[model samples]
Target: MEKMTLSSKTREAQSPTEKWMRYLGFPGGILLFLLILFLPPGAGLSASAQSGAACFALALVWWVTEPFPTYVTSLVLMFLLLVTRTSNAKAIMDVLGMEVIWLNLLAFILSSMLVKTRLAKRMALWLVVRFGHKATWALLAFLVLQLVLAPLIPATAARCVMTLPLMIVVATIYGSTEATPNAFGKNLMLLNLACISVLSSITMTGSSANLIAVGLIQNMGGHRVYYMDWMRVGAPVAILTMVLMWILGQKLLFRMKPGEQVPQVEGGLDLVRRQYEAMGPLGFQEKKAIAIFGLVLFLWMTDIFHMRWFGVEISAPFAALLGAVIVLFPRWGILSWAEADIPWHLLIFSAGAYAGGLALDDTGAAEWGVRMLFGGMNLKGVPFGLTYTVVVSVMMYSHLLTTSKTVRTLIMIPIIISLAKALGWNPLSLALPAALCIDWVVGLPISGKPNVVLFSTNQFTVSDNFKYGMMTCTIGVLILVLSGATWFHWLGITPSFWAVAP
Candidate 1:
């Protein structure tokens, strides 16, 4: 559940957007599926491939619209896959056994260690006390908090749960509340939401979708993507994007008023200080959480050196399992099995999404779709730079339509990779960059779980979020596009934009 969505109530058919979606989502899914199902086969698309595409369309419609609970839609997807013979029951079952699912389970266990131990809260409060003196510094502290927590906790929701109260507390102290708010509160909440998403893009374990993308790249694209390989490219781009967002949000988007710039309530800073003091000295549990998480992170980061030093490789799932093992160990561990927060539904949902993706690949649906898409664009003589811009841009902005990162990865990555291969370009050059952009689900309050949780405080409006999201989205696209031609080209992740020809 790394990059686990935080808010379960985000799409609960209450809001105006979701209300319409509720009415239209199911019928829309069925119509799309029927239309695709009845399409006259041609252009190298097989019958099985056509069926797979239809199933994907239905599942995607439901996922985006939330006509059913996302998990319920996933269940229906699995059933449709089997009934339509898009993927066999055995292949669907094997989706549960993928390392991506295992990593997700273990990552949540690791996250529970941080949440239960209160280590994550302690770190967050300490940072704010150290940096929350001013509104600007306080916002930056939360930004740093998400960055620090992204790798350690693995689950984005868990990190949000840990820091959410702290965010509310700091926002309140700075004179922002649910009923009444200010620029400071708006910036704080929105900035934290954006950072949580973009920062997760840097590490493979930061979210399940990232891991799923890696698995797809390895299995379907035939190119292995290692943890460091993602971090090596993603860390620079994501971190820089977050910093820019931090600056642009406060300076350009949501400038603070003089009165709102400082703590509004009497002794506001003192309240934060008291909370930090209430944490008392670091206890045994906090130290152990730190130690356990430290060991896991070390393994995740130093993966390339493992084959040389240990004569064996510790994959991402195994590294997490090792840490989770220590966390659940009877004597050495801090939490009981009951204490670990594992959401089996979310896990199942992830499996179904991934299974649908693999079925598309197995049936050649993804390839056929990519070929049709590229054929219409007539990319025959297009330079890689221009084509690269279009590819990453679509992946970056696709969040507006598809709310689930898992669904986005399942739908987009295979097509992007297949498109790159069709053009004789390295798949990673297109696929990995597209994967990194998948986590920028910041445009709408309904875009992600954390956005919903933060929006509950009423600190930022839909318009406020939309404006900030567009700015960050545009910035992310520009950064990826520029980096593709320079930094990535220099690093050989993207060899040359000019090398690809038709």
Candidate 2:
């Protein structure tokens, strides 16, 4: 028995397949780099551009395959770009200091403050205590909590971590254990996952991928998507999707039992109330954090107004930095430097990805690739509506193939921009809707961190998640298509297919 146990442990420790998978990235990247190096430079692109394209291909392979840490691959990408003389060291490093990077950094600091101050938990507890009398309303309360927290906590995984314990508690109170989940438990867990991923699109700062998308859009010479612009388009879809999910959960998907209409969770409301009271009234630090965030949000929304009156625009990153500074001030600040949960790995990866994007632009590699892929397709004459639907649909459903939202953004946005240019349509029209689809990553357990986290609760099975996720994902795509045809058309985002010649 002892020997059998040892053998089992050894087998579980590291499968040969897993070992080879991790090592594949290095050789795969090398082969791609060599292939691009040896390929003839296409017309309208320089030899240096060809090298840059090769570096990007190497980065893409490593990023997707995960032979190394994603950030490590980013470092490799920067090193290769410099060694290959595709770009200089200074140029590559400067990408780290881009405005988008700072925006993400400040956003992280702000999110950390929320976590540290316990203000997010307080708000959630208050909502649940106030409205959680019934199972359906309790589920709605949690959804509302997520909606409120999404903008403040940009990282979906962080928000999920914060709420997971509470979700487990609620499930227990309702007599929905991991071994025996009621409809209410399954609904609550799945809905939490859906809300975390879907609502991430409703604000520009709601997720790093959204900001990355904005940066790439600007790289492609499209209009920058401001916080207000994203809110205008994404808010309606988010709200509609949440409402639809609520209805589906109650009626179509997970029908609540009659007893579930009024949960008999002994002391569940009291537990939440006590938790809220234990916070002992809002602290000075929480008040200060809220004030700083409010001011920052105001400045972000009224940026154009500032430019008009003061003849100087306050960019989003500047506003965020200002807020972060106040939140970290000596006297009234909410968080210490050590407490800031900054994901330096993601920052480094983003910097390298941005640099790669710049190389693609400078070397004309983006355009060259576009021409090579679409040049022979005669797609210039395709109708705008059909193209819009196809692009949005593909972007929405593509989440099943990969898990990293950043990777999806890095790969898809540039290609979409290039395709839009090739087809002579508004790049924003195609790219923005596609960008919104970045956070719709709840279709599989590996689709996103939140999905993974929620699945671990064991209240819902994989089949449960797949059913709920696929249905909602399909609905989400329809919402995008409908908005493009109606709301986007009214906003002048989608021009008439016949307006311009091919």
Candidate 3:
């Protein structure tokens, strides 16, 4: 009995390092748990700040771990925030109407119909079959398709979920596994999928974070990132990145044998075509969805210019809500309420994220954080362009931590802008594109919701994700820096980049 008791005690007393290693990958959850256990007294924050920090940690843990349904976790966090005064009840209530969240919900419904109708499947299979049997061509087709689909779809998860199953099917057909082909093909396919996904933010409607970035840019820096403006600057970068991906992806990730025959996928395109055909002449629901989506796009693109009738200006959020309502017109016999199948969990997550942002604003956390950060790393007498370049570069590379890219961007833009201005720089020149592309460096599945959806399939392992992620991040940093320098120069703000201190 004594020996048994001693053994039990020994087992219970494991080192902190050992426990930390077990949970290292889930930093968001671990960080939150630590904060809850040890709230610093007089941390120079209001009660709201403390409550926000706790809720932020809880929401983040749930988001990263996903032990409960994501929406449920989000709601719990939002509830905690409201009850604890982390956010005012009114502001917390307002999080529901956040344009990006509603847009994603509507987009998900349309995506569901596309899935049910097998339209997305048919499209992917068509690309695979048309590309002959080469792996490179297959990847290229997927990349091009994602780029084209991003502007229209508006939600990265919808895009990824639509395409990922098809990619898995293709990978399975090729017999690519972690152990097979020296882990080459598996890594390549996963990496390519991840790399292309970043392009989702190139358009205003592609990802929620991009929308948030647009709003923050306007609010913080007085610069509005219009839809066309984003496309104009972003399209070029996306095109160049895709080209580089083809080259590096093949060389670094996977090397296909020259004579390796691509396996024949049985009933591949035929199955997809047949399934789509089964939908049998588009229903009124699909037509209505098409019309609503088309109208939203038309209004957003043109509404910026024309607002004459009753002075009725159409905001993006309002337009999305309008489309969402039209989706469920009982009289029109369009989509049913049950058929919408919205991911309410994501909306909950949005509420928690927005609550955190509100907490920062309410408690002056953003301002306080900016001051401390500047005090610690004060770059003296640096050229404004050089300082801007360094700050933007760091911000872009810091996305390996969180799952919600929207939350990450929202957190960074406010702090970064505050810091940039204190350092004697025009914050917009440094902050605008940084706000836009910070989430683009998401190299892991947990870096964004799109990534999680893509990772759900057993196509890639965590190691596979990290190996490819590191390379992609390296490439991203270089591209962002060079592009920023070039774009600034083109805009007549020639940058004199300071050499990094050893």
Candidate 4:
């Protein structure tokens, strides 16, 4: 098998045509920006707003085409905003320290502790050993393991890396070698990737993209989505989707042989046991990391309780930071600064993106764009149920076009929020559901990091993934739409469709 780097797997091979497109992307973006900037001032947009609009156009082109690294584009965005006087240096710098950025940083630290202590691997092995006697049970074991680690790990790529080897071992145990694939191997890899993507949407800290969505919503003056709040709305959809995928895999996609129904592998359970035992006993450091993470989760979930009794409200970032501090405190700490796998590039990208968003909002560019795009649609008169359904569906299937979940969130959430304000509807009603769909990056091998990792296994082809992915993506969209009409209504996210005057 050929060994490819992570970057090589995630990035597609560029054709000569694509190379030309990349070359033209930057100049085209600048031209578009200049055109927008010099256009006649209509729709009540001021000169500064026009400049912001121009900056956004150029940023969008750079973001979508990758004339440079996305993080570089982000830095360029901040610089452009400053040069144009669309935003001041203090404002641009201030966005770098926003609560969202801190939450992401602390989450990275916590995740680093998990990776360093090897607790994540231990938990996965333990689960597979206990419940993986049957093919169906084995699949469910992986799904449940991912769900358990989603909040704690935060990074989808890291979790995928931790589980990929185990998945390969399981496939080999079932006699499904990459050279000779079978129903079980195909289903196992595809379903594992799908479940990881879906589970990421269930918690705010589940993925960086989720946090980006939440930050964008908060920037738009909507109510903050806390850990509990996201779980309340996203949990049902996530769980239902997982169950649906399991049914699809077992019944329709992968047909198990009669002998394969039971754990027929000569030493399937033994493999897991040996791996589990290799770690030896749980070390003191692992125990300390576990305790600190538990305390953080408790504080995050019970913020309201602490606020009422102690008159001190602890934000999610602060709680996470507190846990991270305890983990790095010299005497009791488990992780060292050198061991931290923090993606500094992502943080830099996020800072610039946040600054761009802030400039758009401040210069009224977001509002202007919203009016220009949706003002004539009379979307305000459409029933909330129908509108919500369409928006969620669009967001879910958008993965077919682009591979970057963070970029998708960056582009979609702000537009949805602006649309909500234009239509006189609660921004959360539209933005939350759309943001929740940010993690639905399962339609292609390039859709997300997990997909890339799983695809490299050679257990399945592109066609296999597309067939299963399209089916699952469609089902996921339907679940979100149905929930928006009923479940979300009960939670005060989706309004009564018929109650409003058309």
RMSD of each: 7.5, 9.7, 9.7, 8.8
Q: Give the Cα error of residue 149 in candidate 2, in Å.
A: 11
Worst 10 residues of 3 by lDDT: 1-10
The per-prediction tally of clashing pairs is 3, 0, 1, 0
Worst window of 10 by summed lDDT in candidate 4: 1-10
- Evaluated against the true structure, the overall lDDT of model 1 is 0.77
State the weakest 10-residue window (summed lDDT) of model 1. 1-10
Candidate 3 local accuracy as lDDT? Answer: 0.57
Candidates in order, TM-scores: namely 0.66, 0.57, 0.62, 0.59
Error of 3 at 292 (Å): 5.3
- Give per-residue CA lDDT, model 2, range 131-191, as digits (tens): 7677788888888889998877666765675566567656655667655667888899899
lDDT of each residue in 392-458, candidate 3, tens digit only: 5566556643434655677778877776666655656666667656547446544555554444343
Pull out the clashing pairs in model 1: 1-104, 2-207, 3-207
Mark the regions of model 2 whose C-alpha exceeds 4 Å error after superposition.
Answer: 1-20, 127-273, 308-311, 379-502
lDDT of 2: 0.74
TM-score order, best first, reads 1, 3, 4, 2
Q: Compose the digit string of candidate 4's lDDT tens values, residues 287-349.
A: 987798788877765665777877997767777788888888886688788766555665666
Clashing pairs in 2: none
- Model 1 TM-score (2 dp): 0.66
